[model samples]
Target: MTTTRDKLEMVLARLAARAEDERVFMGLYPEAARAAADAADDRRLAGVSLGPLDGMLVSIKDLFDVAGEVTTAGSIVLRDAPPAAKDAAIVSRLRQAGAVILGKTGMVEFAFSGLGLNPNYGTPGNAVDPARIPGGSSSGAGVSVAEGTSEIAIGSDTGGSVRIPAAFNGVVGFKPTARRVPLDGAFPLAPSLDSIGPLARNVQHCALADAVMAGEEPHILDPYPLAGLRIGVPRGRLFAETEGMVEIAFEKTLGLLGRTGARIVDHDIDDLLRAMREATLHASIAAIEAAEIHADWLTTRAEDIDPRVHHWLVRSSAVPAHIYLRMMRRRRSLIEAMDRRLAVVDVLALPTTAITAPLMAPLEADEVLYNDADRLILRNTQMANQFDLTSVSLPLPHCERPVGLMLVARHGSDRRLLEIAAGIEALLAS
Candidate 1:
């Protein structure tokens, strides 16, 4: 769909001027289109393409610094964090790939909740069902890709931020190994747990976007048979907490994989849970880092932030050093345990979230219920972060509340993990 004459610019204009009656799901900033088009023209004339993703539009989560714009992170706190001297590293990578920086997509406030509620900017409406929650922190990122607002979106996953929205919105979102992408200029929710990932139309699209974002050579592979692939199913335990419908969906999905020649074996969720407790990646670990980041603002702009986020920030400041240290030690031990287990398994598969997306309106009204649901949303996905596993969440179909299958590989096996996930996606589709 590209022509030699400023193709990127043409798309930018078409997207920018598109009717507002179009979609409230994701927001776009196509103002950079002209410059992107010039860069595209320059690359074409030089007789070389940036990469496979040249001249495409990308939506960024609001948490990252986008040069000259505010890094809201779905909150009003950092309205003045010095309008990013330059784009976040990922944004720079997108530009390098000849991808147009479409705009800053929406997110959960302070990247705290799983439900995509933006009291100030207004939540990014879910395209699937108006009555259903869009899923958050990476809320808008998922909707952006699903609604065609942008082909791909870059979002952070502190606690299921990226994957939750993808599952809710019926798209693909992958949380790469923690350190795969540089977090230099991205805002932090929980430093140790915070990760940057992609929300795109499909697994391949996420792979493409991740390559550009991580500044690594892209690995594009066709789907392969699952036989000889040692897939681990943490059968009894992880499956224990799942609901009836969730259990049915999980079995059906596993059945599909079995039929496709994949070897499903036994695994225990205890490994992940153990790491999460040790790493303190949850309430204590995440809270402390966040408290440090917002130390100054918490006092100065305490009243400015949303009350829900303010509540979390206030509680975050109370995590003591002794607890934090012990947790770190625990983290190392858990990682070692995971490494040993993963060495034998080709991939570890689990549901992305324990439950499906909740209703938006009810969650909006009750803060207590909202917090409980947020933890429920974060249950399965956070374990990957605790162990620093490279994980990809794939949306599964034929279910009422859509669930995601998360496949994780030990520390930096992102490329291999993506390939494996692609196979599972193909099997499910078939």
Candidate 2:
């Protein structure tokens, strides 16, 4: 007899079978998934499963090291790297908890850029509109989940890599406070700001993935009630450049969040405009790290790297020591101010992306990524990094264009944020 577990596994098999042509996976290790899934089915049949996510399939960003696979970070330069001796810390935890490692997904080279484009690997098409881009460096991970290739997708967020694509695809993306997820096995982007998180079809899945990535017990928290919840509305730099429909979709989301009985308050912070400069920080940091990691290969095999990433590294190598240190220090001060403001609300709500995904064909034709690309992609997401907040991007309904209504809370408040998101998700779906 085909069990309920068999039905889900069949769905996954069909999804994974088409994974390659989707341009979403950097590489899918099907043998690994099959073996793991078969074992998982046995456990499920025996009624000895580990957790609710036991049988779930997880798609990982290429930046994460998986045993027997090179950690490419979507770069050709690492094509010769030795197969990883061990899985990254997060991957190990997910596996131990019974989540099948579906495959490695494509990402921006070196996980440097915000817009998910890889000249070498070919960018994954956004689910909403194939003509558009999938936000990166967690690009493929986003598409994998949104397209149902995986039950959940794990990715790293430097500035907005995780949230941008989540917003673009109308899925739930969560970037827990930077320090929450251990970064030992993943390729580094920005040591100070990089965090591993997840994208799921809904908030509950995201919450489960967050716990596994963070090495916490994966228990779903009670849903949030907006009745007495104080939600902060941004009044400064955060809303500086609102896209036409984005503004409409965001306002509509707020109205819904407000109608749920949450106490909405506006907050003013002139200093946020200053944080705008941090958009370049992750790229600069990633570039420096990339150069350090690829130093030897770079000297002789530079052309092997995607040109856009090579250029980003060259620019990053030029960052002065004092400037880098100042940016690092600035992050702390910004976090303090952000926390002070959040003291007034259970969560801060805003649009996750300033605009919808832009056309990729033109940029592909030009053989160059645009200059303003990162700015637009990193614009809204930088705040969570700036303030070191735990954030989730929830999808909105009633619009032809999908929007992510972002909800952010203070550091260590990830659990609460997920709970709040569950309520918001239920409301949106209803």
Candidate 3:
């Protein structure tokens, strides 16, 4: 029988052994974590454990404010920033649920890129293949869980930050509706699109963590029946750049679901595809908003910001006000369009990433290569964010490496999405 302290010590030893390699945790609160574990053990002994997450070790992304610790958000610029005065809302909720937060994990600088290449703190390697890039901006968050340093990783997803890393590292990642989880203390990326979610071993773990973070009671999940489930696969641009292996994995999963009496429909989402493309032609709500939040720093301390992040921020200042306003108006129209299109289907399905994790060397060496890779990784996942949908990425079975099959639901459909994902997960495992 493993005690809470025993689990903590084993994880600590694993972290220590890898300390000399690529960085994963940006800050480790060993003393605090051990103390918290002791308390959880005491509660367990007294038969009064807090809840589902009592004694579970978790890692928060650097974007979250842990009281008394400066949030670096995977950047060097905020290292000297003042410590947080209070815990971020989710952190407080996690504490209330008796979750022991082990530390802060590294991330993409200012949560900018899908490729988690952090020059400031070394990027955490993919658990499947150390030489490939770990997806980001929640890069370390995914790696921490995948490598067994933590049971769950708390990360923010503006443009697939949580799901991308989860896909790369062979874990489950959930992105609830944008407004479902409060983002008060999280560092802003695109305020309109940023959402907090979990990277964990399975759908149930994500559900439990999400419930805690949302300030609700954690509940057991009953998997939805796969029979008669309506799953729509977008036909056009969604498949344009998909890699051979990803396509095979995805098609195979769809076939398996279909064999179990699932209704698989191909959707011609040309309007949705157009909306996504138009979003790129104008001011990115994420880039412009991120630029606004970091303007002062970019103006005075540009030297401290990551060049890739700085490149986008500096470019954002040139976007005309009229274009930004037009984009914002179009955003509402598109969200409505997506909702109507998805009304008939229980969920939309696609490969979480167009390509598998790429090697870091070429992307880092060339700006063009980096931007292209970033776009590919962010493409499919960004739709859910832009359309205000709830989504989850589940690892497909028997892939030589990890490949994620993403399932998306209409806005505010988080609970249903999770139940649906739970069903898919169970079906895949069988």
Candidate 4:
């Protein structure tokens, strides 16, 4: 039997061998992790187990509070900020579950962009192709899982942070309904849309971590039967601008599901999506809310912030309070409309991202390119956040580059969505 200590040692050694420029992790807790792993090994020897996550190597995004460490949120502006007085709620929960936390992973600045390029902390390259972008702001979280540095990685998804990285890195990422997991200790990007989730090698690991973080009892996942399952495909604007490979893979998967006793139907939501898009023409809810969170810093430390992040924050700060309120009210009604629309299907299926990870050089060198890619990368995943739903990104098999098939469910249907994802995962594996 491979002991937890063995796994921890292997991970630590691999991390040690990396070049200093590889910024997959912001910090590492070797001594602490060793202690935890040894403790877990001892428990196993004595025929005791804390839970499914016991002895697992876990990594947390930099935005999550780690007692006595400053939560940088992938920006340098907060480097001098006071250290957190205590660990974040999820961190405490993971520790209680006997998870051996490796360290804090890297993220996009302020969790604002999904491109994963962090000039402040060197960007962590994609696990599959080092030159390509490792989707973010949970870039390091996804890479850690893909590269085997962490068995599970916890990340916050405001607008596809968790799922985007998972898609690019070829792993499983789950974004529970916004409020399903407590947000008390996470740094806010958009308080109303922020959700804490996990990126791991498989759906079951995500489900286990999600339940633990949500303060719920973890249970065995019985893969929901794929036969007779109703999967709705919202095929309009969301399908536009997709890469050729992504489209081919998605269509093939749909065909396979259809042949396997699943019912695939066209479920149009373009009107609702269009309205939501028009409402945010000036600024997104995430940007507007983030602007408030960083208002003080925006004025005093603008130079310290990432230019891409600063630009959006500046634009969002200009949004009038009444307009923000009006958008909020309209958003609630749209959420209701979406929930009603989803009642006809078991879940919604779409490509997690429109394209696979693009090369980092082009995006980094050209601001225009960066902006366009960022918008497209975040486009589909943001829908769930805006409409208030639960979603997961499952990596597609046999793709040269990783592509994710996203499954979205109604609000508060996190467990059911995970169960369904597990079934699809097994089907694809077969």
Off by over 4 Å in 1: 1-27, 38-47, 222-224, 271-275, 278-282
Off by over 4 Å in 3: none
Give model 4's TM-score versus the native structure: 0.99
Give lDDT tens digits, candidate 1, residues 220-318. 866655888888987654565676676778778888888767789887768567546646644556667788788888878877887887787788787
Candidate 2: tens digits of C-alpha lDDT, residues 1-430: 6543564567567755775565788777666777877888898778797887787888899999988888888888878889999999999999998888878888988887777888887888898887888888899888878877777999989888899889888788999998899998898877877888999998888888888778888897789886878888876777877787888988887787778788888866556546635534454544565566666766578888777667766766667777767766776777787788778778888888877788887766664446576676686787787668888888788767667888889998989899999988887777
Per-residue error for 340 in candidate 2, Å, reads 2.0
What does candidate 1 score in Cα RMSD to the true structure?
A: 2.8
Displacement of residue 309 (Cα, Å) in model 3 is 1.2
lDDT of all predictions: 0.77, 0.80, 0.91, 0.95
The runs of at least 3 residues in candidate 2 whose Cα sits more than 4 Å from the true structure, single-residue gaps closed, are 1-22, 275-299, 366-369
Q: Which candidate gets the maximum TM-score versus the true structure?
A: 4
Report residue 135 deviation for candidate 1 (angstroms).
1.3
After superposition on all CA atoms, what RMSD does each candidate show versus the true structure?
A: 2.8, 2.5, 1.0, 0.7
Clashing pairs in 4: none
Which of the predicted structures, 3 or 4, would earn the higher lDDT when compared with the native? 4
Q: Candidate 2's C-alpha lDDT?
A: 0.80
- What would the per-residue lDDT of candidate 4 be over residues 1-430, giving only the tens digit for each residue? 8999999998888888884766999999899999999999999999999999999999999998989889999999999999999999999999999999989999999999998999988999999999999999999999999999999999999999999999999999999999999888899999989999999999999999999999999988999998899999999999999999999999999988998899999999999999998888779999999999999999899899999999999999999999999999999999999999999999999999999999999999999999999999999999999999999999999998999999999999999999999999999999
- TM-score preference between candidates 2 and 4, better one: 4
lDDT of each residue in 159-209, candidate 3, tens digit only: 899999999999999999997899989998989999999999999999999
